[model samples]
Target chain A: MIRILLPAHLRTLARIDGELLLAIEGEATQGSLLSAIEGRYPQLLGTIRDQITLQRRPFLRFFACERDLSHEASDTPLPGPVVAGEEPFIILGAIAGG
Target chain B: MSKVRVLVGTRKGAFILNSDGKRQQWDVSGPHFGGWEIYHMKGSPVDPNRIYASQSSGWFGQLIQRSDDGGKTWEPVGNKFAYAGVPGTHQWYDGTPHPWEFKRVWHLEPSLHDPDTVYAGVEDAAIFRTTDGGKAWEEMPGLRGHGSGPHWQPGAGGMCLHTILLDPSDPQRIFIAISAAGAFRTDDGGATWKPINRGLHSQYIPDPNAEVGHCVHHIAMNPARPGVLFMQKHWDVMRSDNAGDSWQEVSGNLPTDFGFAIDIHSHEPDTVYVVPIKSDSEHYPLEGKLRVFRSRTGGNEWEPLTKGLPQQNCYVNVLRDAMAVDSLDDCGVYFGTTGGQVYASADGGDSWNAIVHDLPAVLSVEVQTLP
Candidate 1:
């Protein structure tokens, strides 16, 4: 089991509208973890990652174990803590300015 | 870091808009240099204490203003920063001398490498630079149009430069994109300019390759990787790998690549952000929906962020200078629309809040982390 935290904006989209928990059936990886999360929250499928390429959206950032994981490859395994269900996978929409 | 105030230049005048952390309230001030049409305003990123303003009149020529004490008060910086020639140096219209008395310094950019140097793209259809902190300036001769006889008119946005991005790593290299004219690059500090629009298609000519006049509205470069850039062209979005030396059309998956500005993630050189809209029409999002598109791995992929956003008809056009990102660990993306709404995403983009509604047309929104 893995916990997933959505930005305030995504919370409104999932209709789950709150903290979400996802159960997976594979080795921990951005792709597999995302698949399980999206499988449960179907409406969020194309919003987070491209449905076709499974790529994170342009303005979105991913974090794991308190680190920026958005730019890391999708195939990268979720941190061991997340795999062990001790930590949650965090997906944030990146905000930018000068 | 201190409270970063947003400098907005508009038709009314220059305005200093301040925001409380979450954008709960925005304090708008000025018409600072009233009576002049202020086109470009900037607060130096390296030195928040200094600010620059660009203004022009169809009859009075061009002027720039500086504020040392923020925007609480402003003073005209004088001919030192103004672009002008004696009365009859160039052809005149409407009985006034000087080439079409400067309409606007369409774009003003501060060099990332040397904050002392300031660049302004103006209406005389030329680019001007100031080295001694706007205390006197010189023109980059190459920015002048080679084939542009007095007869060739400035296109949609005027013979103006709307965007200029400086390379932080290499001070000598720079990219300048002018509307109606092709893009150009100078690797040796404007000593010479080389046309860098090889792959950028021009809509003016029948044979795309042969066209010379391509309109580029705005262009952005990653501070991390100077050469990696994106441009919102007339009909498409082009990514340039060798600075502006060459470009590749990457709007394959976009609902529409027609946009005013292109911004990249502050930390990630490959990530890009854009507000897409159909080209021919008044540039509204496809399906009447307002969405900000993202390409995480350098245009290789794109996805929309509609979470916590309006699901109904969205008729707001966001100017390139208006959208911004907080980039906090969880990063915050905020952008204001012509509809007078400011929307923010606290979780890098996962969720959003309509922080402020029904404000004046928000010309720009820049956030600064205060110590």
Candidate 2:
């Protein structure tokens, strides 16, 4: 089981109260996790990333295990704690704009 | 008895105001899609119950919300707006080639005959159509494929295709206006287009009468007379007789012609309304008085309709897509301001009342006359 924490607006969009728990089939990478998340809640398809380019929106970031993982390769393995489901992968909106 | 549903899109969320034919009292139901920028919300003329909203945010990007039950409930549809083909470049503000990007949708114009078909005018200046209601969108590349598209540039409000005017008489002919790119017309459905901007003299641009590159603020045409079109350009009030073939300035006696938000009356084809702002730099009512100017003589002669509007220290700007009219017996004129007030004149700009006092800085206003 992988735990993911979405931003407030995305959480509201997905209608999820707390963290999302998804069981990964293969390696627990950002690409695999996001594919699963979008598969479950299709409404959040283009919210966190561009639909055509599949690039993370400039205003959004990814973090887990007290490290900034947004720049990491999408297929790169997540932190051990995040993969172990002990620490949740956090999808955060950047602290900018009014 | 017939009622009117006013769909107001604001900087934050969407609001729906309902009132009977009287248009006196109102029941406001909103902040729907709260905390998101509702750029435009419009109901289909063919199916009033079907409403499409362009809900977006700088953080979450763009979303299309569809309401089948007349703004009562909404469901998120498609948000992907991919540009066709290579999606080449247009002139940026500094006259540099900027790659065309897909931004948020600025306006949604539903089909006149089919509820499932709709057109979207989006930022970065392009048009897209969705045939399956709002589930999917495909770009009509001809508008951007025009030879002069490489020279088109953005206005101060970004390069946005803000106006989509469907020709009621000829279904194949459609008119769309972009911020600094001027107006374009397509005679063959959405396949091809031509820039219909002659006699438009913009002092800001290099050649005052250039073919393309005019910042048209807004354009309005009565469906009854599709041939005659009225435009509120960045600096002048213009009228076109031969369906955008040529334009002539009709800004006769107005204080300042720089303003946004123009609409024509429902019954009377010659009757038009425009809220004149001070200037493009100072986007507020002149002399701190909010007055709606009506041109009954089609454009030259104008009268100020200022009965119920604020005449004292008011500074609110009416955006390009924030004015609409209901086809009721009395022809209600509605507009929303940057100060978050939605004003409605039940009797065709005779008197006005604020249907909603405080919203989140309205971006667009659209009305649907319900039976």
Candidate 3:
């Protein structure tokens, strides 16, 4: 089980209250986790990343286990605590003011 | 009893204001899609219940939302807006070749006949149409494929195709205006287009009479007289009688011609309205007094309508897409300002009242008259 936490706007868009728990089939990588998340909630297909380029949006970051994984390769395995459901992988919006 | 629903898109969210035929009382329902910039929301002319909204964010990119129940419920649809082929380059601010990029949708114009079809005017200057409501969008690349596209440059605002006017008399004829690319018309549907700026003179460009570098703010035409088009250009109010083949300046007896929003009266096609701002550098109303100028003679002669509008200490601006008209018997005129006030005139432009006092600096206003 992989626990993931979305930003406030994404949570409102996906209509989920708290953290999302997903069952990963293979290695818990960013690519596989995003694919699974988008497959489950199709409305979030292009919110966190670009649909055509498949690049993460510049104003969004991925973090887990008190470290920034935004620059990590999509195929790289997530932190052990995130994959084991001990700590939730977090997708946060930049702190830029509106 | 007839009803009027005003769809207002703001920097923060979308707001829907409902009122009866009298237009005395109102009901506000919103901050829908809260915390996101709702650039434009418009209802289909054929089916008033069907609405399309452009929702975007700096952090999340762009998303299109549709409502079958008149905005009561909304569902996110397809947001993939890829260019047709190799998206070519356009002139950048420094006159350098810049790759075209999709930023966000600036306007949405629903089809006049088909509820499922809508046209989206996006930045980087292109038009996309969705036939399955808001589910899928395909670029109509003919507009951007014109010969002079490479020289097109962005206006003070990004290079945005912010105006899309559909001709009701002839289904095959469509008119679209970009920020600094001027306006173009398509005679054979969306397959081909030609620049329609013949008599436009802009001092900002090297050649004052260039065909494709005029910055048109907004264009309006009453469906009754589709051939007669009125334009609020970057510095002049113009009129084109031969369907934009040639234009002549109609900015007569007006204070300053620099403005943004422009619209025609619902019942009176000859009556035009415009809000004159200070200048391009100073966007506020002149002398801190907000007033709406009306020209009943189509142009040349004008009068300032200020029955209820602020005459002093008002420094708000009306955007290009922030004005609209309701086609009731009396003809209601409405416009939203940068100060977050939506002022409406139930009986044309004679009187005004703020339907919504504060709403996150409105970006666009659209009204639908319900039977």
CAPRI tier of model 1: incorrect
- Give one digit per residue, the lDDT tens place, for model 1 in B1-371: 23335565555455666665554466767656554556667766676556777765332335676776777766555333233343122322321233533445776787655556788877645678888777667777654533332322355556666677777888778777766566777888777776677897765644465434566777877677887888878778888887776789888688777887567776777777788866645856767787888888788478888887786788777766666665445556767776767777656665667766665555555554444
Q: Indicate the DockQ of the complex predicted as candidate 2.
A: 0.84
Look at candidate 3 and tell me the lDDT of residue A27. 88
User: What's the count of clashing pairs in each model shown?
Assistant: 20, 0, 0
For model 3, the superposed segments whose C-alpha errors exceed 4 Å read: none
lDDT per residue (tens digit) for residues B1-371 in model 2? 99999999998899999999999899999989999999999889989999999999988899999999999989899989999899889999889899999879999999999999999999999999999999999999999988888989999988999999999899999999998989999999989999999999999889989999999989999999999999999999999999999999999999999999899999999999999999989999999999999999899899999999999999999999999999998899999999999999989999999988999899999999989
**DockQ score of candidate 1?**
0.01
Per-residue lDDT of model 3, residues B138-228, tens digit only: 9999989887889889999899999999999998999999989899999988899999999999998889899898899999999999999
- What local lDDT does model 2 show for residue B348? 92
Angstrom error of the Cα, residue B158, model 3: value is: 0.9
Residue pairs in candidate 2 whose N, alpha carbon or C atoms collide under 3 angstroms = none
Worst window of 10 by summed lDDT in candidate 1 chain B: B87-96
Query: Cα miss at B154, model 1 (Å)?
Result: 2.5
Better of 1 and 2 by TM-score: 2
TM values, all candidates: 0.68, 0.99, 0.99
